[model samples]
Target: MNIYAIIETGGKQLRVESGRFYDIRHFASLKSQNLSSNTKILIYRVLLICNEATISLGQPWLKNAIIKGRILHSHLENKITVYKMNSKKKTRCKFGHRQNSTRFVVDSISLNGKEL
Candidate 1:
């Protein structure tokens, strides 16, 4: 069995596994610094983690849990169209929006006093 963790990011919960890549909402300001493909970051908002038979849960977030990952790239999310119409009032509105997001590759997961 493999170890996995549940994390909260971008107002959503995601189940992430080690050595994999996932897309998450962008929260960093990269306007002043240059980024490379190997730049690493730490994610600390771990809610839960299960390793085979042992399970760890946090009231809100684990105090000493950390997930190490590297930024893969940043891109715009898919455009979503919102349409509103009224039959008798003759009102119509259409709008489209695209959200900024980033991709990260998980490197490792560690906990306080233990390593997995």
Candidate 2:
């Protein structure tokens, strides 16, 4: 049966499927752990999951439901220009920002105490 799950990470909710890759925001403190690009990680905050015709929902987060994934890579996002200008004051400020993000590949989904 085809299975998928919704997980929360980096203050965002994402719909993920097994064997697929997604780019997500990086954790601030994870850099201290010296995580490699191929590191495997388990995310336990599953919000919802659907297996074939059956669905399970969590009241915030599901117990015993987890998403296993691997870190494919990490990179910075495209730079965005922030421009602030005043019409009469003749003040113009410009800045560039780039966000750090990580690429993750979902390996498996475990639900109801079993891996699917």
Q: Quote the lDDT for 8 in model 1.
A: 84
Writing each residue's lDDT as its tens digit, candidate 2 over 9-67 gives: 88889999999999988743367255578887889889999999889999999998988
- Model 1, span 31-116: residue lDDT tens: 31434566788788899999888899999999899988888887889999999999999999999999877888988888995767
**Per-residue lDDT for 17 in model 2?**
92
Most accurate candidate by TM-score: 2
Please list the residue runs of candidate 1 whose C-alpha ends up more than 4 Å from where it truly belongs after superposition. 28-36
TM-score of each: 0.84, 0.91
Question: Deviation in angstroms for 53 in model 1?
Answer: 0.8
Q: Best-fitting candidate, measured by lDDT? A: 2
